[model samples]
Target: MVGSGQLRLLAGTLCAYERDGLAYELQQALVYVDDLLVVGNSMKGINCLKSLLDKEFNIKDLGELRYFLGMEVARAAQGINICQRKYALNLIKDTIFLGAKPYSNPMDSNAKLYEKCGTVFKGPSKYSRIVGRLIHLTHTRPDIVYSVSHLSQFLANPTNLHYQVALRIVKYLKNEPGKGLFYPSQNNTKVKGFSDFDFDWGSDLDTRRSITGLCFSLVTPSFHGRVRDKKQSQGPQQKQNIAL
Candidate 1:
């Protein structure tokens, strides 16, 4: 199990118990913020740890683990399915993109984005605030990660062009409001990661730092991989920036 804030200590205590053999058959567990993730093979092991929590803490048993940390969990014979439908919906509503028309893609393939050298923002703070919220939404919405990361580049001094690009992202979100990453049950368990760079993709901007995009997949319980790259090299550089 994983948790945040006050639950951090609870998670730590659980780990210690597993380490000491007080909780049997436990391999590993992780706690971050207020989320808890527990992994074990035996029912006895999980039950033992749960018993410890019941006896030592006031934690409630949510039972069967349907949801955790914004990811929706569902158990089936094939395996588990995890998605972030709720998180995406809330994000759309928060950004007032709930009723907007949806776009087929998060960004236009032909759109070229650049820093508006002399343009000033009419509401710099508002743009920053919206982009900030979208950034958080990216945790479960990888489809928009590149778009949000691009928009975030202009938070320090967002221009009219930046705001327009940001709105375009919101509009994109509106079109595919239900889109999210899907973790299939039947797949290899290997973990893998891949990384690539777009050299000087942002050279046109003063920062000159190329954007990096990455994706990860698990082929087995012990194996997974990731892929990363610069957004511009794959297509046109959207008028967006990330603050270092």
Candidate 2:
């Protein structure tokens, strides 16, 4: 049995095996702490693996997955929809932004954030807390990713202007609490990636760094992404690697 390194944080362990006679048939078992998910193309294979597992450990079958972590999962004939509506509403309610005006955009493109742009915010923790929550929301809400990431840079010393912009992001979430990703049931496994580098060089006032954004998708819907400001390399070798 092979183990997965990616999900080690949740004490997750993965075991995958191919059926001896059937080369096309592959089965996988993902164990996250005590919860286990058995997946395979054939029911017979899945059941056989589960039976073996049940012999060693007491297991309860949860049937079909409806929810896991903060993501709400709904399956249909066409696709699987995952969202965090409840989580979003709770965040909005806790922040007292439920009645705030909804925003058409997460962040204003014209706005530029600087470290010492404005007076330091009184409740710095509040700003950090809100921005942290927004970062979690980005798991299902990629639309707010850039905004959240931008705000995260100021967590150490957020200003009143930064705090106001952070609240604006909460208002934006109020616009569509149920916004999420949909993975079609019938789709190709081909991976596609798109990336963009900021044309406006050295946009970050404090670090004088440029930003790079990348998104990777399966077929059409993006599943993984990152938006981060690039820092200057310490050495010439590292700088060459960054350029490459």
Candidate 3:
């Protein structure tokens, strides 16, 4: 018992826990490595939890969260905007496509990729590094999620074609590096989800599997969303997982 009530670690989460106070006040803390983010319905409750934590571990309060783990956070009367504009710019600079012409689309619909079709790329590490960074950028740039997912399948045996496609995505990022999600101030607690499946059976040339795309959002009267793509062997199981 930290103060008046018991503080319990929440199940199914890495390092998240909650503390309760008298009068039904509650606060929660999310710990990621050395960083801690605290949230609660009331400032008094949050402070109480922090005090308890400070007594146990030496912790520094970093004021309001403006940035964390490369994601930029900005708040206003309208809402909060999260983006990785600086990270995206740095990604572009690290690649050869900095001055390449921007494309309207992230991927080419006409191009189909196969495992053993193109000549193997000599520098697989270069392709892996860029694709890895692109995966991290997906935290704020959901627009490239599908394209990046498509290219990731080739990381182990990347080809010249795969490397070229990866560069194309970097070129596409040049169009609007600052593009990101916005959470409006006038939003409700309703959660919304959307999903799509590629009907083409041979979408995956190597495995002949189909790709399912899912998106989840908070209802801000507008959808602020994140996207995920999965390749599934069975339809019913994947659909059930999507339902949850």
Candidate 4:
């Protein structure tokens, strides 16, 4: 029984123990940030563990677990459904992207963003900071992962064109603030991955490297994926796959 910093490690240890059949009384336990949830077959067993935790740390009994880390958990006879709709909505509101129109895709396929020779940056740092925030938002918004990654290459010395592209992404977010990841009750449970590369994508620059892209998806459990790109040709190739 643990809380706070030790809670996650203890949960892992308990899970391993349960998997090894070392414990029968402890049924299920979940840890998120500073919160801990322990469910056992008998009330006596749960109370015993709770008492131990209370002695060790200042513990709060939350009873049944409904939400953790912004994820809503609902338990039923069929299965458990987890969603972050509220979190997603809040994020959109925080970013002020709620009222914007939603686009069917993350980025435009026809747009070509690149730095040209003799192009002077009016304010590189400010543009870079905005792009950086957009990149972080891609963690939950996979749709924009490729676009954000593609735009990140010019972070060090972003040009005016780069800033325009980043602004477009922000505008897109404004259009579809409510959109987010959805985990259905039924999905395929297969792990599939895709990889691609673009040759001489950064031909405009002195660094002559192609961009590489990779994506991994679990057809079942949860249908979520991430897309990452390099600085050169390989990066745009990855973005293309993500857009598809």
Best of the candidates, TM-score: 3
Ranking by TM-score: 3, 2, 1, 4
lDDT-wise, the better of 1 and 2 is 2
Between candidates 3 and 4, name the one with more favorable TM-score: 3
Going through the candidates in the order shown, the clash numbers are 34, 0, 0, 11
Greater TM-score among 1 and 2 belongs to 2
Residue ranges of candidate 4 with Cα displaced over 4 Å: 1-16, 19-55, 61-105, 115-125, 199-206, 219-244
Name model 1 segments beyond 4 Å from true.
Answer: 1-24, 27-39, 110-118, 199-204, 212-217, 220-244
lDDT of 3 by residue, 112-209 (tens): 98877689999999999999999999888777898898889888999999998888899888888777788778868888899999887668888988
Record all residue pairs in model 2 with backbone atoms less than 3 Å apart, i.e. clashing.
none
TM-score of 4: 0.57
In the range 91-179, model 4's lDDT, one tens digit per residue, is 44554456565555656777766756336678877777677667656645667787888778777777777776666676666544434
Model 2, 9-56: lDDT tens per residue? 234534444545646454566655555666678676666666656555
| TM-score for each of the candidates | 0.67, 0.77, 0.79, 0.57
Which of candidates 1 and 4 reaches a greater lDDT? 1
lDDT of 1 by residue, 76-177 (tens): 565554455565567667766466776667776455556665488988888988788677667556677777777776688888877777777777766554
| Higher-ranked by lDDT: 2 or 4 | 2
**Model 3: what TM-score?**
0.79
